[model samples]
Target: MKFFNKTGKLAIGSRLRMLTEKITEDAANIYKLYDIELQPKWFPVFYVLSQGEAKIVTDIAKEIGHSHPSVSKIVSEMAKQGLITEKKDKADGRRNMVTLSPKGKMIAEKIKDQYADVNAAIEQLTAQTENDLWKAIEEWEFLLEQKSLLTRVGEQRKNREGSYVQIIDYIPTHREAFKNLNEQWISQWFKMEEADYKALDNPQGYILDKGGYILVALYNNQPVGVCALIKMNDPVYDYELAKMAVSPTAQGKSIGWLLGNAIIEKARSLGAGKIYLESNTILKPAVNLYHKLGFQKVGGRPSPYERSNIQMELIIKSSPFQKTAE
Candidate 1:
């Protein structure tokens, strides 16, 4: 406790692990009191099997959010202890289906009463605290999912090493770097359509000459990232933020964030009210970056690209780009 107090937030992982170890120790005693021969670590797999459905290791792992090997290890232990039965799946020969044994079913029935008592005890324990730890943990999980600790630390690292990065207006030399960067990431995930080639082949003719603007991110005088503000003919949005790409060698350095904020500021300077973009949900990191740039999802518009499954827009009139993570 004293070490944790001194270490403060740096000991979060250790603190949470210490709490789990304590709970597990108490749980072992509780299982002994109930006379159930079950391992505390096997409870999740056991509970899943007790629901009356035979599941393969993959399905059990997905449902419980554990790994395939982790669930398989517990299932093997349970089978060895005569608490569960494992058989080859009828639908798939490569998979093994697992279910509770008769002894396991009897223990499951006995555990029902124990489950109720433990729930009541936990409720009483939580009621003694000022805040609900269960709700806090849920929120913490959600926030972590949105932005991981590694990403947060990377942003700080970017700020510290940002002197080498420069955001400047597009130049003729960046044309090839821009197209190649976009093509590299696109081909890895989705095919580049005709629209991509038209712009990537000639940014000046397809975008800039049409009243659009492009920005390039240079790391140590070498172009590594690019973003385009395509002038849109739509009434609601003034520009379509498109052709954003960062080289694989330059990723995780917050180049995307810097380029995105620079583009938003460029849009504002051009008197733009709103900006629109199309993206696929499978590009999770890109979508998360757009969300960080204050983009909100919208619908009812057809896309020019087959890979576009989701659409997002950002109102730039009132929303000033704030580098929140940095």
Candidate 2:
């Protein structure tokens, strides 16, 4: 009986380890085929060195989300392979600076070429299904992020309950709630014509179809705010955030901030490099929110709508608030 139990557990553990080993073996094969010497552990270190100066081992560990001891072991292995060298930091005796050696630079250059090749191979493999696959992945990732945020917010509220809210995806059921909120916003700020308001209301019609999204804020299960993203056709920028609205009752409670930030986070997660929004001077609070979120004024462009107004753009990739949103 004891032998049988031990055999059963060993079998299960062996199968799990075998699966993990297979994945590592496949990745190693790819690296070998591409003549790339850097393994998963070495890639980040090589990436940092390729960027500029030798980084402290602790900094490398932080950037790669690894323990210092783990990074040190990898670095030591890399040094043995003549891929990296460690030097003492002059100012800090405790820290060691890690730099790539000449052979490491050669391998890094080959890795860059292989990176493009691997992407091309993937593109070829998914040529027929890439669009749908990417869309599903994006939506799944977005929903996961929202769920994660809800959990974090819920935990925080338990400790110190505040005026926090989590808005989920916008679907047909929430259409009327979002429309009413937008109508109130237009009435107060833009004095937008019925047609203009109508166009904005059907965000799906205007822009939400092209990797765009609509999310509605809920308080006690009642929709009180809305935000939408529009993928830009610009060759330079990837997308823009637009159609942000919050009901007057929810105005001062930072609902707008939450909506704006959610849109930005979703955009960044979808690989958008920058995001811009149009607004008028009358909406000072909205503009202030944008500024607080690191948006800066850009040269005014003609509005698509005759209502025409001021435009502000945020370089999402460079914004300091990116990680917080993530």
Candidate 3:
């Protein structure tokens, strides 16, 4: 406990394992007190069989949240102790069904009272605590299911490294990176169209020289992402957010978000009132990122690329507001 206090949350796995061992040891002692000749690990299987239905090892494992091999080992131990009987399944000859033997059934009947007592004791213990451990554990499990511990740690690592990432104006050096990043993503999802080559092949002539701007995200002084604000001649929209791409390795580091905000600022500085973007619905993450940057879905826009099926626009405001999304 003192070591855990010093190490904090980093030793959570070790602490949980230690706690489980203590509980398991106490459970074994409790079974002995009940005069039940059963291993603590085999109780779940025994209880399930007591309900009068034969089950296979796979079913038992699923019901008790254990692995197939673990349940198989416990079944073998119970069989060796003459506590369970196994027979070929009538429905499937290759499969074997398991059920409690006479000795196991007798022990199950004797443990009914013990089960009630243990349930009441557990309830009393939880009621005495300031916060119910059972409910707290359920909440923790739900949160972990939403975002796994590995994903959370990966995001933290990305955020730490993100400090070294810089958003800068596009230059000749980033031309190859810009083309390759966009091409990689496009070729993975959709075929590159003539419009893609026109812009990606010559970003300066097609976008930058035409009263537009491009922003590049550099992580460790290397280009990882690119976003372009192409000048539009439409009546409602002043600029189009186009050709946004990030390297697969550099994803989840907020590079796309950084480039998006920088390009929006540049559009505002150029006296732009609205920014538009065309994207496909299949690119869910990209569409979500656009929405986080204050872009709203719109209709009635013609696209040069066949892959574009959705259009969005953002209204530029005079004062900058803090973004809430990462």
Candidate 4:
């Protein structure tokens, strides 16, 4: 398969962008077919302005759910084309009012029937889907307006779940949590090895006290996922990324990513380079996650555990947060 087509069209954001481009192209074609000399981007402002006597920029922005600066820029372009006019408000001296021009009114009148057919065509196109995307988007947008997606998740966690996950450094009390989570997975898949028991027996002495660090994910004050960064060869200190596990019951909550990134960050805080891990391919999600966090495969590192087959390493860099994630 070619590189771009390899993901089988499963890239949601890319797919959505492709769909948006198609619709935008169709819109442009419809405007051309009707001989309307206007860009699709100009339509919202133009159509909204046509319905009212005059409106201020703030009012138009609020009606369209767009930023004031965005609406202002559009208004500026429309004013340049003599499609709209700006004047001081009679009632409020500080406010500027925007009104459609005579030329714009004539154009609106000329294209009324054409725009009606365009709307009907769009409605027909959308109606073929089982779930109305327009209606789904309206609801999604409303929820987003109430609170951002992450904020809503946090709110739900606080209100409904009653507790949230916190990533914290290894403590004496977290020994059993670190042990049980690791032991459960290891024993279930491949019997717990001697090295597993040694670390689980004394995490602080074996891991934390040896220039290594453990990050544990706690939900409702109980540990859900745990990972440790082990120190090796100083000056160019390499870190062994090992013993990462998320409790099966708490699996799908992204606690593993939290623990994984936290361990990577811990390596950074310790001024280390080349964090590496060994794993079996059976753990597909874990392998994929390592890849996601910039780990590249390097075969045959002589892993201590019998289950080890795949080895990967991460060279640390600055962490950049996604806007919504932040």
lDDT of each: 0.92, 0.75, 0.92, 0.83
lDDT of 2 by residue, 1-326 (tens): 46546788546546657766986787688898877776865666678777768998788889977798888888899999998878888998887888888888787777777789777976886786636665775796788677875575566654442255777898878778767777777777556775456446676676666667888888767888888787778875677676678777765567777788788888877778788787877778888999988788888886765554778888866346656666
**Which residue pairs in candidate 3 collide?**
none
Q: Give the TM-score of candidate 1.
A: 0.55
Model 3 residue runs over 4 Å out of place are: 56-58, 88-96, 116-128, 171-206, 235-237, 264-326
Each model's TM-score, in the order given? Answer: 0.55, 0.46, 0.73, 0.50
Writing each residue's lDDT as its tens digit, candidate 4 over 158-262 gives 454423678998889888888889989888889988888888998888887888888889887888889988877644338889999998888667677777878
Worst 10 residues of 3 by lDDT: 317-326
Candidate number that wins on lDDT, 1 or 4 = 1
- The alpha-carbon RMSD values of the candidates against the true structure, listed in the order shown, are 9.2, 18.9, 5.0, 18.4
Q: In model 1, which runs have C-alpha deviations exceeding 4 angstroms?
A: 160-326
Best by TM-score: 3
Better of 1 and 4 by TM-score: 1
Candidate 4, residue 112: lDDT: 90
For model 3, residues 101-139, the per-residue Cα lDDT tens digits are 999889889999999999999999988889988988999
The local distance difference test score of model 1 is 0.92
